[model samples]
Target: MQRRRLLKLGIGAAVIIGVAGAGIALIKPGLVDGKLGPGAREVMRAAAQAVLSDLLPSGAARDAALQAQLARLDATIAGFPAATRKELSDALGLLGTAAGRYALVGLSIAWAQASTQDVQQALDAMRLSSSNTRQQVYHALRDLNVIAFFTEPANWQAAGYPGQREIP
Candidate 1:
């Protein structure tokens, strides 16, 4: 009887915590109309610059390309399933917070204010973190940036991927 009562209490507590967590996540201000909100966008832009710095040439060209790629990323994220989108938004929200930024990226400042090297260091730390969730966030952000960058026809040459070959 004791074991059964304890099991029931544990299950009830788990359900309550899960419901509260979901409620808090839904009320977070980092998402706008089921899309990447401003805070998320800022984090992603900084992350993109840090992750793709080597491939991006300097000056107006790089700026233009980054802007276009960010747009593509935004569109792609907008189409993600609700759960996936919520996870991403939550991650972004955490990174946007100063305490979470320091914990994850080793920076106490906002991502926009952090230098590229600092952002890179943070991302590297996340990639190497013991936490699987941190690693997942790092990989997901990097993958999105890479896919958006490499899929452009202009970048195909750089990646040595010839435009779609016409099979006779």
Candidate 2:
């Protein structure tokens, strides 16, 4: 009976956390009507830096790459179906807020203010966390960053994927 009760309680807590996070997103809104509302770029930029650390070039080259990657990500996301876009927007919005950042990302610092190492550790934690929600969030961010970075043909070499040859 005790085990069953604890299981119920655990499930309930998870649901509450999920709902509260969604509530924060609803109030602050990651995107404004299927668009980048505010702080979304910072969130994505910081995440990309950490997620693609070794993959990005050094110094000024890295900065330029990030800008280009972000642009590509923005354009790609814009083309997504409305429902997927809204969900992504909501997730980004949640990460932008302090509550969501602490709860989902395990970081209290603002995305722009966080060091790449710090963000990387937080992402690692999310990846290793026992919570399914945390793992899912990590995957979403990781996949998005990876996709955004690789969309540019110039980056293919870095990923060991040479540009495709024209059909004969």
Candidate 3:
């Protein structure tokens, strides 16, 4: 009876260890501050663009022009190999606070120019959100509108735009 009890105790300990190991194995690794997978990166870029476009002027000409520019950016990304995309996305994930500030500044300016009061509020909150907080990032894009508010061509050029047609 003593030997049987010892064996049962050992079996129970082994079962507990096996269950714990299985729980750990079920979790996918490689997540940095809850940011993971190619899909998350893609979603972030898309959300950023949507927030920015809302601050642009609602003119057909500006819409067409910005569409052309975005198409170019998309084409460039599409040209990258899968490995290159992964490398670049990883690098973007690892960017420091200074780079994050620059990115936020550019996006904020775009949002200010094109977005409504609601969108501006959302963008402001997002800019202040903690980098590691994916929930905040996701929430910031919750009620975003995808409109493009824009200015005149001359005004646009004055914003230091590097267009082929120089300001006369």
Best by TM-score: 2
State the displacement of the C-alpha of residue 79, model 2, in Å, after optimal TM-score superposition.
2.0
Candidate 2 is scored at a TM of 0.85
- lDDT agreement of model 2 with the native: 0.87
TM-score of every prediction relative to native: 0.77, 0.85, 0.32
Candidate 3 ranges beyond 4 A from true positions? 1-58, 79-116, 131-158, 161-168
Task: Identify the candidate with maximal lDDT.
Answer: 2
Error of 3 at 131 (Å): 4.1
Clashes of 3: 12
lDDT of 2 by residue, 58-152 (tens): 99999998888788888778889988988898889889988789988999899999999999999999999998988999998899889878888
lDDT of 3 by residue, 8-111 (tens): 99899867754543343233221233333333233333444555554334678655545543443344445657765554344334221223323333333332
